[model samples]
Target: MLDKIYVIDTNVLLQDPKAIYSFQHNEVIIPAVVLEEVDSKKRYMDEVGRNARHVSKLIDSMRGKGKLHEGVALENGGMLRVELNHRSFQYLQDKFVEKTNDNRIIAVALNLLLEEQTKENGRQVILVSKDALVRVKADALGIPAEDFLSDRVVEFNQIYTGYQERFVSSEVLTGFYKNNGIPIETLQCGILYPNQYVILKDTLRKSVSAVGKVDRSRSFLKKCAFDNEHVWGITARNVQQRMALDLLLRRDISLVTMVGKAGTGKTLLAMAAGLMQTEDLNNYKKLLIARPIVPVGKDIGYLPGEKDEKLKPWMQPIYDNLEYLFNVKKSAELDKILAGISSIQVEALTYIRGRSLPEQYIVIDEAQNLTKHEVKTILTRVGEGSKIVMLGDPKQIDHPYLDEYNNGLTYVVEKFKDQQVSGHVKLEKGERSQLAQLAADIL
Candidate 1:
């Protein structure tokens, strides 16, 4: 087999700076235009800027070993090279006359393909990109293209839901309830993770069932702690939500993740649990609600006012849920009430990077827009006595570099399933409204 050449796009590096080493033993080529684009974005104050600077330093360090135009040896037995030639867009002039950065990058791959075709046993050149249009344009120019998939931890359909259904005999089902908890060996099931929810059903009667969660030891199936109780003013409408509430209310579990679609009550229930713990139970000293400021469409740009006013647009959803929970009718009234209650605080995720949050109930909304590194930074900020809940719909990610399978929400759910200190729940039902549920399903 021939070692293929992978031409990476600027977005790929911006999404993950280590993508250059992810090609295994294959040759990796970065178009010169990618460096120029990366330099342009290095001044921003976000993950993209950090990645741009990191990748720039990596490539600059390679200069000591050899000229980038030629090649440099990688630790993974791969080769990294910056393609400086092929700036001419004459080949694609008739097809793509805009002379955009994408076209220039495609030109590099096209020229490499033509050059490699002359060899007796030629290496195939593949254009690797995160942008769909860039891949489409490469295909139009007769070059192979693919999306960078090394960062994706799991397939979308096969992602862990933290729950499963099991059919047991009537005697076992009765014993589970009779004993308050049953040994996991009685289920005779496959491997189960810690804190995983199990719905036990009677084989004779499908309607007769009971829900239990695997204990931290993974040796027993125990009943949920908050199965029928109400948190603040909210109640679980389904089995999954019940499991989520149990995890959220547990002071032992430091990290909780909730994945669901719009109108699924992920954020609302999380807020209720946070409020109940911070205000009602006094388990935590404060409730901090925040979300990423990723705009669904074009950003409205700068706003005039203080930090609170600047954050109102981004944190509106959190405020909406707070209003529903407090039963306030007007924004001014809500603000006044929130000010009186010193336990509740709402802010943007941007300000959370540098602070140590101890003895706080932190709720991160729209967490799917965050990258894995950003999530890691946030999780590390949790001090000695803090519980953080990350809530988001992986399928509804708004971040350009992320998708359903590779976002931070999905990453945490998959990576922390076995640990006793963490728990996860995937809410399927939309409890917001019938119309909202219909829209979520069809749209």
Candidate 2:
């Protein structure tokens, strides 16, 4: 077999450092300009920055084996080398030569191609990049270029986070009421995961009824299980109270993604579930929750105080849910719950890079703000025995270059629909209040 050489672009490493080893036994080359690009992004205090630091640590760890400029032996029996060819582009100067980083990376590929042309071994050198324009430019230069395929594109409509609603016959509806509930065997035929919401319909009357999630044991358990149930001395209204209990008490579906407008109990339900599962049931080790700090078009820098204070505004929704779940009237009381429970953690998505999490229940709220690439990076970090739930409303995306159809939350739902390990639900009805539902529908 002929040895294949893969020239990796900087974006690929920043997206995933382990991408170097994903090519199997093939030789991986890192253009020197790519390293410079990676160095520039290392100072960022975001997810990208953490990934940059991780890649640097990975390369630094390889120094004991050999010099990186030459080549380092990967665990998968592949070679990774940092190419130091500082070539210039006179032809590109006529089109675009402002000493841009993109041009510098392209120049390295051109140099490698020219060097390969004279070799008697005649190995194939492919330019692997995550940037679409760079690959187009490489193709124009008569060089082989392709997108990083290890991450693989997911279909737009197949991903399943495990929530669905189906219409059933009046007879089936009667059976649910007569039997006190439907049978597990009958429900299993249609397929269901824990924490999935289903709407039972009366086909004859054309009316519908909502059903809370059920356990794997087919027990009709409430979803969110709150201990005290009063927040700031205000108890949840009858329906809100029931919905909250439904989310917290259920144990079948490990991952639950809830999407709804404000006041719709999305975050509240998730937090309630985390509290019951972690503090009460002790089913999981800890409750690890995170959300992207990217707020609309503006960055986190515009906020005051340190990273934690600046993150507070974005994390307030999480705290609100926590405060309500703990039934704390005072701010200090809420702090005590956080202080007492070492198992419950609220963190930013920025710090999640390169960490392998296990035996924890993770909830990522407002996931619609994340890009497809960013979501993939977060999901790949899940370790064994961990169930990660992502909740967000696609209609309320705040990230640039992301829309309802292309955001990470929707992307996950469409890509994992067939897989039994994941499930998704789109909360259509806003259970907050009559006014809130009206507002969600009209305004």
- Give candidates' CA RMSD values in order: 1.5, 7.7
The TM-score that candidate 1 achieves is 0.96
Q: Name the lDDT value of residue 215 in candidate 2.
A: 51
Instruction: Write model 1 residue lDDT over 255-274, tens digit each, in one string.
Output: 99999999999999999999
Candidate 2 off by > 4 Å: 2-4, 43-46, 63-73, 86-91, 113-125, 139-145, 149-155, 167-171, 187-191, 198-214, 217-245, 248-256, 260-292, 300-390, 393-424, 429-443
- TM-score of every model versus the real structure: 0.96, 0.60
Once fitted onto the true fold, the runs of candidate 1 whose alpha carbons sit more than 4 angstroms away are 225-228
In model 2, the worst 10-residue window by lDDT is 217-226
- How many clashing pairs per prediction, in order? 0, 26
State the displacement of the C-alpha of residue 188, model 2, in Å, after optimal TM-score superposition.
Answer: 6.5
